[model samples]
Target: MPSLPATLLAFLSILSLVFGGKVLVFPLDGSHWVNMKVLIEELHTRGHNVTVLRASNSWYIKKESPFYTSITVYNSGGIEKELFEEFSRNILVIRRQKRSFWTKLKLVSEVGAVFEEMHRNQLNLMGNIFENKDLMDSLQTAKYDLLLTDPAVGGGFFLAYRLGLPLVLNVRWTMHGEAHFEIAPSPLSYIPVPGLELTDKMTFVQRVQNILVYMFSKFQKARTVSKHYRSFCEKYFGSEINYKAILQDADIWLMRNDFTFEFPRPTMPNIVYMGGFQCKPSKPLPDDLEEFVKSSGDHGLIVMSLGTLFTHLPEDITEEIAAAFAGLPQKIIWRHTGPRPVNIGDNTLLVDWLPQNDLLGHAKTKVFITHGGTNGIQEAIYHGVPILGLPLVFDQPDNLSRMKVRGTAKLLDIAELNRTMFLEALKEVLYNPSYKENIQRLSKVHHDQPMKPLDRAMFWIEFVMRNKGASHLRTQSFRMSWIEYHSIDVILTLLMILVLFCVLIYSIVKCICLKVVLKKKVKTQ
Candidate 1:
């Protein structure tokens, strides 16, 4: 005996479930496929239609899933692949060199140029794909409800703008980029920029260095990347849109970081922390791997992986790592891609890949040696395993630096790594009960949230759709320029006022002194 209104509301709810939204996702890096897969699958299970536009080399789209649609974009002129190859070569050079900080900075500047070239190629590919009449017709017919993209990839933002869809930025790393400042308050005073490897508890000198670095990064972005991105939009979209302003228009920011691990900073309501979303229930180890772990007995185990990109290490470095592992009593499982090292001992097992999360979850696991990729670090944190980090490049140094400060990890410079140094660091982490205790405490904090990270991400995504872009959540600062946002103009005005007041007081005092002198002279006469 329900009322007509109640019956109609129930019907509408059913209708909404039946006809869920269509979401288009543009992932930046190939490694991001693993992370995006989790969110994409969840959205699919919830009756939402999901489509991913991915590169051909993307390992995430192995076989088509029944849950979502996939479209592969070609490399076009092989430029993207070439740029990646050049980048890998440069990394090898940097890894082998024993250079000063300034020398390393110069090397990285060259690498940044490579990145710019790669970005241009990606933009060209995106432009060609979006401009295709057939693809455009099909996309328009599908009528996607929202666009989810990695802000690191400028092309995705341009595509979203062209399609006239609400945009959600999904950053797959803990490190927020320049675009983040436009949406949230990321003060350089305390929050160190990623890649600097500086901690939040910085000395006065370090703060000054941090400020200079931040300004330099801003200048670099403006001088190089932003202009190209703006040009791309104008050329393709036929509109002159401010690139940074487009970032502010984003509906939500799905950042892959937890506050527990990061420095405390101001975050906007629209930014959601979906860290550890990729940390799934550990799958059963393969038969041989399980047997290997069982054979290790009381000595425990050590798992080493330098992530997808850093899989191939130099032979000398590999031999050093092998020598360290050989000295350890624990069984070692190393993920490596290059030729087998000559020094790998009987205690070590080498493989093309390891079930990283599953191996970390093993009870026998003692410590994780990693490249300090955000995914690997988060996974290690989730499993309560201590880390010995060989941070290679980009945010790896910074990520490991934070972990070291938190007492859960130790970091070593890859350029200076030797067998003795590696072994000493490993022994310290493995023997120290404090590292285990600290990591366990952090793991608890990470897992103690009310809702799971994936569920939280899903809720916010649906919330954005429900509210139609969630414009109310945006801050007024989003529309402000850098000077206005930081209130530099206001500070300057106050300084000028103070100067004028001081001048006025000095003039008044001087006039009073002249009058006293004149009165004294008159009395003498």
Candidate 2:
């Protein structure tokens, strides 16, 4: 009786041990880890044991963390810090050139080459993992409840299959293209392909352009990215298991986008939209930063960050942006890692990093100047901050395009950026009340969801764990051949039957006419 409380605590611990599942995560590195870490923490809070697989040279994923135990895989060659930095430098250079069809093509080619190399690197790492008998044995013996991964790379897919674990994808992109296109039905007519920067409402010409771009994407996937993965699959998983099928076999896709940020498109039962899941109410800023922000008086502060990968723009570009900021009455907080710009003003604060979500949620924060990464866009939407966008690389332009179409943002070309243009764009966003009202409206809709995005995601993850897999919700379309999936073979059969019927009818009519002509001849003789 004296130790009743202690006894209850022990029982609760036992209960949690019995009920909590063991999740093995093979996550993508860099900004993707930010999203995955959120889920890992949530799972840990719910008493689940998490083990993360990380490359030894990973930029972001830490070997030590309070929430999850990390298993460091040595000699794994994936996208390294140097590769991204080099690629970013190339992109900046290419974008600074005169805009033309050839220039745009060069930019596209540069991106394709970089991604292809990344995929190849990931495949090599996956092969190493497969060859490691000790690692394989350890993974097999651990008896993981499920495999949670980002499908941007193919390693997790192969590992999950090898370990016979139920797979759940924390995905927005696969190796080939958008995750939805990989599993769900994406009509080119209505669902604009990524990188096209076209909206769902497309004119006839735009649709044609969409189809051409879609074909090019498919060709690139088949020729470069998918070929490597397919070869790896055949070598390891056997000839019978298609790499595409392995990608589509995921139990669930925890999409990092919601309708608020994405255009309306066909989705799947297993596709869970968890956009802005990582966002929350802003905490109080540091006293110094708060004081600086307050110094603006009635003029609110503007927060600017170009996301993680491209923290600092070219020197000339930064100078132009800094000069533009200097002219503004509102104070500026910019996250820049490079050398200080010469035109820096007293009102501007340059920091290596800032609490982006916290600043966006600040009531006095009026405008968000960004490179339009998905995470930044979602945060701005959650906090209802209008955007003055300078999209740099990858999907940044496309992301900003979506916001521009929604009238919540204005896009500026990085190549043509100058002090005057930058200033004008900032003024438009600041003075144009419509931008603020629209973003606020979207924010309201985002907040009015039935369940919080993160909670919903956690529920689905646990749901898959309890059910072993959500195969019931997964579509079998991936198993079908292209001909079968599109009903082309069936259509051809139907066409053949119709042709035979018509030919039979024609023959019968011809024989009847010939017989009638012979009878008339016989009667004449």
Candidate 3:
């Protein structure tokens, strides 16, 4: 028989396997729920205790779902609806406005106000949640092992910092903005800002514009948003914690992007690319969807959506799209909202929602008509579907720009869209074998990994928990100031030395010339 100590040790090991580490996740964007959902579910399946703190009015994050334990942190019922409505209106104005730099800037300023309001509301919501001493005490007693948050919402980082837990950021979009640059090196000379739509190969003027815009955005955020956020942290946490330092101290950054889809840029060792982590093999479609797809026969199918936010398009734009689809032989499956267009096509199927990924994975899915959201693009890429992009706003244009460069997609400005343009773009993507060929080639690269993206993300998450924050993987640059990180001080010191040397050489030359002149005068005399 085994020794009692050895048997006890074996039983403890089994217990450890049965009860994994506890994880707390705060997902910011409702649209981003899909990205975090898979990781959260997988962790729960692997015996980890996962708790998701979600807004009560979230479009996703069902409380009844048994996937994980969900705690409602905020209960602002109408705020989200009002914010989305205002956002939709702003988008309409932007789409109708003349395309000019000033016009775009003006629209962005107007939209900025809406976002500012949303931020303030979110802060208030967070404040309400934190003020509940009972809930706070309960959470504190639970003693979570780590915190995974989407920092885009602005409150998650502060909460994580307050809890004194290992922080892991889930950036569901491509890394950009001030917080992203503070941790990773994003050179303005090449890597485009998320909304700017510029590619890696920027012209001289483009580079200058990019740098100016980047600087202006950082300055604006510091001036306007930073103070409010700082005050919130101080008010709730009862300490003046430097949020930037907290961000830098983060254990891991799980980005929803791949280098194949994005421009090459410097990434820290702790930054892991978990792109397509939510993607999976197509499940059997719902009966109606399966029948609708089968109705296409050999004509093939096109799937169109503007994702969760922009599904309610303007009437004229909707009419234009419907008309365009009406002319096409291929059957159309559009996920749309609002009143149906006047000219609804016979071949088109309009539903409030559809299983997008499953439809994309279908054999008949020839092309994806999308707003170029990262998740949607990743899904299309995973299924090897060519894209006809109608880029709406923020990062959509940039995503499509990359796809256009890759020859896997074509872009159309939603502001300038017409039936003819839409039809031409759609036909080109459908008829051109190059788009399909390119996407297929890239899909192989996307799938050619040692482990699946979800597995990789889970491994890193567990690794952080096991090692208590993977501090060794953190880059030394995170501790450096911006000037020091860029070596500006070194460059300035070298320039000063070079200038001093030049001045000394000039003084020596002047003395030599004068002495030579005096000698010549004496010799002549």
Candidate 4:
């Protein structure tokens, strides 16, 4: 039987593979990109069809996330974990900021942009959702086993839900309590109280952090903030919209953050920890750049990059930055998008963009001065280089502040702070062996994780496909009541009990009054 009909058997095997195999890998890229494209490139090698359907039409990501950019993955576990621990150590900073009325007003004014991003998914957020949906439609021409997407856009998750396919939401930053709301006694989603900052406790500040992260990473609030988005999606799909489809359709959710950084995993499954997904030492830099960095010699080289987005710094900030670097003996390589200062000093070099990961990986590099992007932080850790985080806005300050507390980086408020103070901070990092030592320790912890995050994520994706879309991994919380999910029902029950007790007391008083009236009448008669 086996010898007969060789063509028939060959056809049957091929048919089986076609009917049940093949994965449509979707790397839904967008503007203001990170190393996600690099992840997509690597994952495509697994004999799966890969399509990068997300558009980076925006100025920010288009320039940063080129299809041909070189990428390297670092395995620095020690420094990463150490940095996270350092963040835990400084819980009191964001915690005890007991604001006066005036201070609260000022704080609100300072953080106004952040608050706006939170409640309303304004700016380019609407455009992003539409683009993501278009990409899914294009990909849907063929069936996909699962969708691997960042949690920001959320359209991919909706696609998976509609197609009845398994999906994974890669968490780019900490997004706490977005899943539930009736926060009683705690903001944490069940993480133990003691390990709040380090591993488990949400506390109020962390909860706020969670909100900030989600808002800044492309606003997801389509109803109020993005009525245009809701209407557009409705027009296109002809259905009631899913406000939280981003977190809901995820059969598996991969967090780019780790337990070392935030509260520990609390009752969430099909969740994989791959926080340092982009943390790694990449390929070597060009010889010229290496030689330039090496030429700094005894003074050492300082990398001053404003990262991709905020490179368009104000002239005031630029002049201050130049003045500050002028004081330091160390040579500064500022990642600038504007004109270099007239009569540029011998010790400073300004470039529109430098190969960041490559420079960080180099030995000649002394310290990193960056805008506190997560990818940059991971790269610095991988290289075991200390940082001087000059965070501008968004999650930059928070990320940098975490690093600063970890003893790897010192924060400098470059916007308003003068040049003298900036120079002093740089000097401290340059002369500080403690910063280097701490970073080295953290580097080890960051890499010492149980498994390579990317591989783990790839395995889950494959597992879902092989299991014919393991939808069971998705949580029932997707359909659960806000009261049940947030546990507000319990609070309501307590309120009801209190009300009953009050009613019982009132009834007892009324009964006593009636009795008194009856007794008085009888005595008089």
Q: Of the candidates shown, which would achieve the greatest TM-score relative to the real structure? A: 2
Every candidate's lDDT: 0.81, 0.90, 0.82, 0.58
State candidate 4's TM-score.
Answer: 0.68
TM-score, candidate number 2: 0.95
Candidate 2 achieves a global lDDT of 0.90
Clashes of each: 0, 0, 0, 26
List residue ranges in candidate 2 displaced over 4 A.
Answer: 1-17, 76-78, 510-525
Candidate 3's TM-score: 0.88
lDDT of 1 by residue, 385-470 (tens): 99999877767777888899999998888778899999999999999999999999999999999999999999888887766687
* Residue ranges of candidate 4 with Cα displaced over 4 Å: 1-32, 55-141, 173-241, 263-267, 486-525
- Looking at candidate 4, the ten consecutive residues that score lowest on lDDT are 70-79
**Reference-based TM-score of each model:** 0.88, 0.95, 0.88, 0.68
Error of 1 at 118 (Å): 2.4
Q: Per-residue lDDT tens digits of candidate 2, residues 33-59?
A: 999999999999888999998888888
Q: Residue-wise lDDT of candidate 3 within 25-51, one digit each (tens)? A: 877656777778878888877778889
